[model samples]
Target chain A: MLFEVTADPLHPQPLIDHVRKDESGAVAVFLGVVRDNSRGRRVLHLEYDAYPEMATSVMRGIAEDAMERWPLTDVAIQHRTGRLEIGETSLLIAVSSPHRAEAFAACHHLVDRFKESVPIWKKEVWEGGEVWIEGEPVERS
Target chain B: MKARVRLFARLADLAGTRETEVELGEGLSAADAFRLLCQRFPELADHSDSVMYAVNAEYVNSDHSLRDGDELALIPPVSGGDRAV
Candidate 1:
C-alpha cells in the first residue's frame, strides 16, 4: 500500500516516518532528484509521465520483490509525475530491516529493478531542447 | 474485436494522443494491433523495435493474442533513473 504515483511535488519525511518501526534497527532511504545539468546541457526542468495504474502496480511488485529477497520489515516507494524544477525530489524509497545490511541491500535492489521495469518516463528539458532519457529504446520507426 | 490502446511517453507524443480505440480481426494478435496503430500513426512505426506491449497493464510478448475490450499499452523504454538529472 506504500507504493504510489503522484503529480505533485514529493516530500521524503513522510515516507521516512511511515517506514520507521521500533523492531527495525536500520532504515535505508533513497531520494531521486532532478539536477541542473544533463549531457552538458543546462537542464531547466524535467517532465515525468506515467501510466499511473501500471506504475503503481509495478512499484508494489518491486517492494514485494525486495521483501521476498531480503528480511525487510517495510518498504515504501513514491514517485512524482509532472514538471519539476532543478533539485526537486522526484522519487523516494525507504526500507526498514533488522540489520543495516538487509536494509541497504533491499533499497538498492528495489531502485535498480524499479528503474528497469517500471512504466515511468522522464523528459529532460534544456535551454533549447528536450529529449527523453534512455529507457527501452524506441527503434522501429 | 476492439481494444483500447494506451500510449505513453514518446509514443503518446508521436501519436498526439494518449489513448485510442483500434479495431482488430477476431483472431488478431497484439503485434497485429500494434501494426495497425503504426498504420494509423506512421510515426510510431519507427519505434516498433524499441516498444513493448502490455495487456491489461501486465507486460506481455507481442505475439500474445488479443481479446475484445482488453486494455493495451504501448510502452517505450521506461526512464526510471537514479541520477540527479
Candidate 2:
C-alpha cells in the first residue's frame, strides 16, 4: 500500500524493498524510464505533469484493484513529475505474491491501468520542438 | 454562482493559463461550464470531444452538476505513461 505521486526523482530499490515479504515467494517490478527518443525525434529530455492530489488517489485505487484481481501480498506504485532527464525512472511499479505468475500479471496490470486513467501527462522535448505526447499537436511557445 | 476551472496540457496552452474562474448558472452541469470556457477560449472548443471532467480532483461525468466555489479540472487527452515510440 505504498502508492504515491511526487515531483522528486524515483528509485526502484526502496519500492522493491517495501513489497518484499518472507511469505511471498515471488516479486515483480516495472520501471518506466524517460527514454531519449520518441516518435522519430532525437535524444533530449522529458517533463511529466500530474494532478498530484488526484493522481496519487487514482494510483492507490489502481493498486487496490490490482490486489483484488490477483493474489497479491503487497503493492506499491510511484510516479514522478516535473523535469526528468534522460534515463531517469519516471515510474516504479512493484508487486509481491506467493507465485511468479500472479506477481507478473499484477505488476503489468498496474502499469496498464495506471497509464490508461491516471491524471498525469508526459511532454516530449527533442531537437527543436516539444509536444504533449498524447494531448495535442507540436507547437512551441 | 462562480466555479474555478482548471486546465491542463494543450488546453492550458490554448487558454494561455492553467486556471480561470467562470460564472455558472444554478443547476448548470460541468459540461455547461466548459461551454462557457469555449466562449472565452474558442480554441478549446476544438478539443471538446476528447475532454474529461474532474470535480475537486475526482473524475466525474460531464453532466455532473456544479455548485458555487467548485473546482473543475478540464483534462485534455492525457499523455499516457507510455512514451516509447
Candidate 3:
C-alpha cells in the first residue's frame, strides 16, 4: 500500500517500515540509483518526469500483480522525479513476505514492470547535450 | 470534440511545447487525432509508428474514439532509468 510518485527524495526506510508485519519474515529492497554513465555518455545530471497520477496508478497495478503471483506480505514502491545527480536514489521498492525467495522475486518483478510500462521519463544531460532515454531509435523511424 | 493533448520527453521537445488544445470531428479515433496533431506540428510524425495513446490516464488503442475534454497523452517507449527511489 505504498505506491507513490514524488518529486521529493526517496528513502527505503518508510517503505520497509510499512511492510513490517508480525507474520512477515523477510523484507527485500530494490534501489535504483542514478549512475554516472549511460550508453557511454558521462551523464552530468538526470531529470525525471512522470504523469504522476497515471504512474502511481500503474505502480499500484504492478504491486497487485506481484501480490497475486507471490505469497507477499506487502509491497511498496516510490519513484522520484525532477533533477537528480549521479549516485542519487531514483527509485525504491520494498517487498515483504513470509520467506526470502518470494520477497526477492516480487521485488525484481515490480521494478521491471515500472521500468517497462510506467509513464515516467528520464532525460540524461551530459556535458554537451541531453536526450530522453526512450530505449529506441533517436532519429525518425 | 475538443481534447487536451499532453506531450512528454522527446515528443514534447519536438513539438516545441508540452500541451496544446486540439479539435476533432465527432467520430474520429485517437489515431485520427494523432494524424491531425502531426499535421499541425509536423515533427511528431517522426514517432507515428511507435506512439502509445492514452486517454484519461489509461492506455488505449489507436482506434479508440476521443471525446471532449479528454486528456490524450502520446507515450513513447518508456525507458525510465535507474534513478532516485
Ranking by TM-score: 1, 3, 2
- Evaluate chain B of model 2: give its TM-score: 0.93
Order the candidates by DockQ, highest first — what do you get? 1, 3, 2
Candidate 3 residue lDDT tens string, A16-98 = 99987889999999888988887777999999878888888888988999999999999988889999998888888899999
Pick out the ten consecutive residues of candidate 2 chain A with the lowest summed lDDT. A132-141
Candidate 2 residues lying further than 4 Å off, grouped into runs, are A135-141, B83-85
Candidate numbers sorted by lDDT from highest down = 1, 3, 2
Kindly list the per-residue Cα lDDT of model 1 for residues A3-40, writing each as its tens digit.
Answer: 88998777888998899888899989999988888767
The TM-score values for the models, in the order shown, are 0.95, 0.92, 0.94
| lDDT, candidate 1, B1-85, per-residue tens | 6899999888999999999998978788888998999888999998877888889998888888999899999998988754432
Assess candidate 1 and give its lDDT. 0.86
- For candidate 3, the clash count comes to 8
Q: Tell me the lDDT of candidate 2.
A: 0.84
Predicted candidate 2 versus true structure: per-residue lDDT over B1-85, tens digit per residue = 8999888877888899998998888799988999999999999998877888889998888899999989999887666566342
lDDT of 2 at A129: 81
Q: If candidate 2 were superposed on the true structure by all CA atoms, what would the RMSD be?
A: 4.2
Query: What stretches of model 1 exceed 4 Å from their correct place?
Result: A136-141, B83-85
